[model samples]
Target: MEGHTGCTTKIVTLCTFKLSDAHVHYRTPLTSYFISHTSHLTSHWQSITLQNLYLIPHTSYPIPHTPYPIPHTSYFILHTSYFINNIYYL
Candidate 1:
């Protein structure tokens, strides 16, 4: 989709695969980036939205953006709802 002319989409997967640190060390850069950010195991879960939506370990606002290669085009508050406990984007 990177080179394709029109791919206005962000894929979200309900990932259930178990992970091992040893296994992740060899992942491709794109996947490794995602796994690294989400690998933080947390007991406390909450969602907050500013320019982007984030699922952090605490109930706070202004969550950090997932560091990845693609650049964000634009931002707006797109409303949020309760989720199953994972990072989300607005």
Candidate 2:
């Protein structure tokens, strides 16, 4: 999925792999900005809070955004759990 407000933007992606024991989850923001930080994926459900929800105007698959574009931004989403896997890209 994709969302855009104007020109500031970052690519957000999430992938989940079902394993025999648990899920192997992959996220773009986590791996892109924090390569040194890693966390184990689990089947357990998680909760998160999303703030400043906006109705983007752009109709791109990978949403583009703000007054100007900002590449490789990690602080795009207020909360990661706000979007499901493969549904939002900003």
Candidate 3:
């Protein structure tokens, strides 16, 4: 379990247990365990996305000893715009 305190902060709860040796002999309730695991995974993924941000951009690495050591104008422009957008949103 963990929590944070900001606009993106979130509280998360996790539960895990192992069946005892004697309890494992009874397999009737195994189906319910699978269902609970699936639901917990789905909720965890949703909560993670809600607490984080992502960015995407086209990128190129320049070769050394070349006349141009940086990305081309088009790629540079795309990366610059991405940075500006994130800054504005934040």
Where does candidate 1 clash, by residue pair?
none
Task: List lDDT for all candidates, in order.
Answer: 0.26, 0.27, 0.22
Q: How accurate is candidate 3 locally (lDDT)?
A: 0.22
lDDT of 1 by residue, 1-90 (tens): 112221123322213222232112123323222222332322121232111123223223232553432223222112223333333543
lDDT: which is higher, 1 or 2? 2
Can you write out model 2's per-residue Cα lDDT over 1-90, one digit (the tens) per residue? Answer: 464333222321122312232222223544321110012222321232222222222222143322333333222322323432232343
Error of 3 at 24 (Å): 35
Query: Can you write out model 3's per-residue Cα lDDT over 2-46, one digit (the tens) per residue?
Result: 333233211223122221211111122223111112222324333
Runs of candidate 1 with Cα error greater than 4 angstroms are 1-12, 26-84
Candidate 1 residue 36 C-alpha distance from true site, Å? 6.5
TM-score of 2: 0.17
| Clash pairs, model 2 backbone | 6-65, 7-65, 7-66, 8-65, 8-66, 10-90
Error of model 3, residue 84, in angstroms: 17
Top lDDT model: 2
